[model samples]
Target: MKDFITPDTGTQIGTLALQNPIMPASGTFSEDLADVFDLDVLGAHVLKTIMHGMRAGNPTPRVCDMPSGMMNAIGIPSKGIDDFRDRMLPYWAGYGAPLVVSISAHSMDEFVRLCEAVSLPGVAAIEANISCPNIEADGRAFAMRPDTTHTVIERLRGCTDLPLWAKLSPNTGEPAEVGRAAQDAGADALVVANTMLGMSIDVASRTPRLGNVMGGMSGPAIKPVALRMTYQCARACHIPVIGCGGISTLEDVLEFLIAGARAVQIGTATFQSPTIMARLVTQLRDWMAAQGVSSLGEIIGTLEIPQAADGVWA
Candidate 1:
């Protein structure tokens, strides 16, 4: 029998240390997953985005299937902070894994308040879902521009001493700039992106498939775009970058790691197989041992590019 080599999968995102680099993206993760696998096996448990007040969310027909991915305008329905603090927090505290609370708000003040509320003990970090519409910016996402991204992060920073992970949006033209803004404003890490804006029409009905007409698209189709953004942000910012998008397979996770992401989030894929995240953690360790790699740091940010005769990257 071959000797079993236990590879180290541990990784660090600012002050928080994860047992592994695999975790579920916000909205895709929930307490229900505990029935399928041990929640403590994951690097961290990133809860679904919670709001300041109870929300009904968007109208019906909020989700639509695409050829390669899915679209949703679920509008971040939440039971509000009170329920989260009173019930959800205590339940999650029982788990051994670190808890990362994801929060969203419509205004700058609301964002700060939400951050402060979730900054209680037992919470490992706060992932600010800044991709949502900001009323202060006329319904534009706070992450759509560097200025607003900085402003919101700066204010949130002042309200909490907990590590803040700013989740960026893919809709912006200046992804690197937005990432840098978040880092400069005190974000400990950056979640490379949120879902891309897309719409699908039902040809037979001649109407939008989603009730909201447009929704955030996620899944394998957006992997390339998300990977690119992850690479760019990883290079532009000094803070660690957490890649999120269509990461369903081990290869997808490897690509993001080489692209400079210190950690990666699994989203839509979890719907297909609830045990995927847990399985990937095992697979990663096995693959590392086979490749003679001992730690995650060896694979993180090790992409190599060849230069042409003209001194340009080929």
Candidate 2:
């Protein structure tokens, strides 16, 4: 048996590099997982998205069931950046999965302030929570519009020296255009996708299932949408892409990578099995060995899409 999961499968996203590219999206796997799985084994860890202030978030009945997945109107509830630094940061440092702090801000100042605060020495990097940009005012996810994404990143980009991974949203006009805007606005890397905006209805009750009328749909349901965005954005932007949405098994991870994702995020799968990440990581290592591949990079974005040259994979 050889050391299949070596540093070569390891790759860099800005200044942060990991043994592999399997990371948990913010909010999917909270810090509470230490009770179940050893956080130290993960390739990278992305903290839950926190904001400038503690948020109560939507109403009751925040989650609901959909066809192949679930929907959540989890409006970014957290203990605020200060509280996170005081209570969570210490614990985050202990786990040490290349700490990537995620923060959401409504106004530009709020995002910059949050970024500066989290730029503390212990944090390896930061992932801008630009996913649901509509939290403040708009009718869509905030990052859904290119201008909003660009402005948010531009304001927060210089707040700290740490690398910024702007998580892109599938709720945009053209996924590729927003990907380009993120790169142009100085994103160190792009996390291709948050959940798709959707609502589930209970026909008998004649109302939405979630507390809020709309919820962010995740899990197997959104996998194909995420794949399309990842493939498209990878070609359009020069920055690296960390794919998310419905990644459940070793095969799913491979699909995203072969389609040109530098790394992939496991979302809804974690909810089903908290320890699934550990198994997936182990499986990926075994798969790599069987394929005679010594490194993960060799397989990243290797798909032979003709449109890759144009920054839009078919």
Q: How accurate locally, in lDDT, is each candidate?
A: 0.94, 0.84
Q: Which stretches of candidate 2 lie above 4 Å from their native place?
A: 1-7, 134-140, 306-314
Model 2: per-residue Cα lDDT over 159-225, one tens digit each: 8778989998878768898888888999999998888889888999998888889889899989999
Off by over 4 Å in 1: 1-4, 309-314
Writing each residue's lDDT as its tens digit, candidate 1 over 98-215 gives: 9999999999999888899999999999999999999988999999999999999999999999999999999999999999999999999999889999998989999998888899
User: For model 1, which pairs clash?
Assistant: none
> Who wins the TM-score comparison?
1
Question: Whole-model lDDT, candidate 2?
Answer: 0.84
Question: Candidate 2: lDDT of 104?
Answer: 82
Q: Give the worst 10-residue stretch by lDDT in candidate 2.
A: 133-142
